[model samples]
Target: MTTGAPTPAYRTSTSQQPRRSRLRTLLPLGLAAWLVLEIWLLTVVAGAAGGFTVFLLLLAGFLLGAMVIKRAGRRAFKNLNEALQRGTAPGQGGGNGLMMLGGLLLMIPGLASDALGLLLLLPPVQKAVGAYAERRLRQATPGTLGDAFQQARIHRPDGKVVPGEVIRDEQ
Candidate 1:
């Protein structure tokens, strides 16, 4: 019969769970509100007299913004994938959540929100965000997260005498 507890899968601890949940709930609501506004704008502009031309212009702008955002998203995802393959965690800082919020903002009826969202979706921007997040993590706990990259080991120079970070001799 053993008395010790099992080890955890991941080393780092996340922030409050309920706060994250509340944000998740609000995200969808914001998205929905923006969508409603977009629909209303489209209807109003198209329905008004002498507004057909304006409607078409707005439509064109929307399509262009969508295309730009799509391209940016693709690039961001590719970079994130590459980072993961290199054994480094990518999109470190609130990445998915940030992207989601950005996308939601982009989905709003205004050109400003669309531009902001597309900026957030860009590969360079995403990378910057990830790097900032990594830096913060390192600042918070030096060598702890990186230590997880490989098995804990301690090595000494000028010779070969030191206790490793991990011991697997239990085998």
Candidate 2:
């Protein structure tokens, strides 16, 4: 007797939908609002004495913060690599999708966005995340993926068994 499920199709398109990310949609609006508010605050603080000085200070702060991030980012990646080389699981993560997003957020031109990105890029924070991931990986059963793929690699023809890549004898 045959089961009722339909035969599965082999070929299918697996492309993801083209939708703007939620953060991408919201971040620009948030940055614009923050820029307006900061400008207003700077005007109020400077108040007829010297608004230009406040703007200059803001510019200086932005430059200093960017420099700090550049330096720290380099250090964090270097240490992360060292940890991996020493055979201890690195606290910091590389090739993580979220961390990449955080880096992109840092590349935004405004102080607020840059600050948020830098916070995300912090080594301690990344390390904590990496530790959690390592724990999960350690707890997983070994050979699960290997067994699944091994079963797939077996070949069966006409109800007779064949294993691995099938090679035919040349006539």
Name the runs in model 1 displaced over 4 angstroms.
Answer: 1-20, 49-51, 66-171
Model 2: weakest 10-residue lDDT segment is 92-101
Alpha carbon lDDT at 120, candidate 2: 64
Q: CA RMSD for every model?
A: 12.4, 11.5
Q: Candidate 2, residues 13-120: lDDT per residue as tens digits? A: 456546789999999999789889656665676885586775665566566556655665776788788998999966633535345545565554444555565666
* Each prediction's whole-model lDDT (CA): 0.65, 0.65
Q: Would you estimate the TM-scores of all the predictions? A: 0.35, 0.39
Off by over 4 Å in 2: 1-29, 93-171
> Which pairs of residues collide in model 2?
91-127
lDDT string, candidate 1, 50-167, tens digits: 4666555556656665665565577678878899899887753345545665666555556456667778777789778778877897798767655654433343455555654554
Error of 2 at 19 (Å): 12
